[model samples]
Target: MIRPDHPASFLEEGPFRTEEDQYFWKALVELTAMEETNQGNLAAFVGVSQGYVSKILAGKQVPKARLRRRFAEFFELAYEDMVALGRQHLESMGYPAEGLPGRRCQVREPAYGGAEAAGRPAAGQGEYSALRSMVRDLRAREAREGTYTEIPLREATASMGGGSTETGDRTLSYLSFRTEWIRSKGNPEYMTAIRAFGDSMEPTIADGSVVLIDEGRRQFVKNKVYYLRYNGQMYIKRLVDAGGRLGIASDSDNNLLLVSDADDFEIIGRCIWTARELD
Candidate 1:
């Protein structure tokens, strides 16, 4: 049986021991003192009450064994430093040093089919499914209202070479920010931003126009514009539910795209607002 009085004795009996035990302990103490200058910081790092740090520093109480490794990691001290410190403290008190507490490892059972075989759904699949449903409901509501929200615009003038009234004025423009325009009402999750692409949305969303997207809605509405993703690429398009089948369409044209594989598309957010520059 190993003596618990000396911490170093535990190392001799165990498979692991540090050669520079004394130096390691001194380094650990110095590091702890340097970083943990106040009781509050020390308590937070050690996950203990502030009173505990004061008690330990004042030599009124010995730190619990649970704190040893935590202190080592928080202070960035080496394993050898922790062992050396424990050994020194035991020797000074004329007590036996016991080995470190054993750590438990958790083992999980293998999934029914291995991780690869489980076939996890691609990212954003759940969100897209939810958005598609919501769009369907929103379209019904919009039909009752009989009118659509108008997008706002901004204007800017382009400078021509050399000031001359004879030359026609050139202008560049875009959408104005609608911070105060969106009432949001009681729905906190509703948000709006300019949509800036047309790869999947074409006529519905011009490349330069801003789009407003809502983070709250999770249902899909057939034949409504939505921000979507296929593979890793992002797209905005109108999604239509052809019975159980999914079809994608661009706002610019009437052609429809079939989406058989769920991995091919993802809904990033719903288009709630759009801004275009007036010519």
Candidate 2:
């Protein structure tokens, strides 16, 4: 039995005893969410019923050796990681790690350009031109230093519920900030303005507030509010680093949301300032 003071012992009292176990489960959820695929598709790919996949995601049922390999293949992850996890589980019980599945082929890289491989539009294609124009416009405006700096207002909204998909290629408009005021924080070119929705981050960040994000500051600062994306979901919250495990917390919610390695987590920028209507 693990001690109560152990930090990484999340769900220690549950069916998940080891980090590898939780990683396997989270990897499934994160990959499925990233791919925008449902459990039904995963079931079809893994030769299992949708109910079984649900059980796996819920940590109610552990996948067998064959099913584990199938999951690795479907997610394009290394099967050896799953095999190593199983070996660790067996070895923890004072049992031999022998007779488990061996290593398989490595994951192959996409044979295309970086942007296309990432499913994003390449240069001069799709909405790429619009995005480039926005960048150029921002650069040109920043070059003409004056009393105020022009900050591009993003067309999308950052919701506290972790779901905001209205990302536009071009900026809706620009909000002028005092040149001295904006310069104190960082370069004006790296600053952006975006509307924030949801009340989970109330008091500190009211609903419908226009939040200023310092895109140049991507470094992780504990307890600071940030605009981030995890598992393909956007969020505006304070990040708490509990040892190695990242915890996403909200001003309105007391519970901390644990972020695992499998989560496609990226800190878009740190929230520096906010302007909201007086209610």
The candidate maximizing lDDT is: 2
- For each candidate, give its TM-score against the true structure: 0.33, 0.47
List model 2 lDDT by residue over 85-188, tens digit each.
33443344352222211111111122123445646554445433433343345445444545678899988678876668665647999888889999999988
lDDT of 2: 0.68
As a whole number from 0 to 100, the lDDT of residue 88 in candidate 1 is 51
- Stretches off by above 4 angstroms in model 2 are 1-145
lDDT of 1: 0.46
Q: Who wins the TM-score comparison? A: 2
- Pairs clashing within candidate 2: none
Residue 229 deviation, candidate 1, in Å? 1.2
Error of 2 at 257 (Å): 1.2
Where's the lowest-lDDT run of ten residues in candidate 1?
A: 156-165
**CA RMSD for every model?**
23.7, 24.7
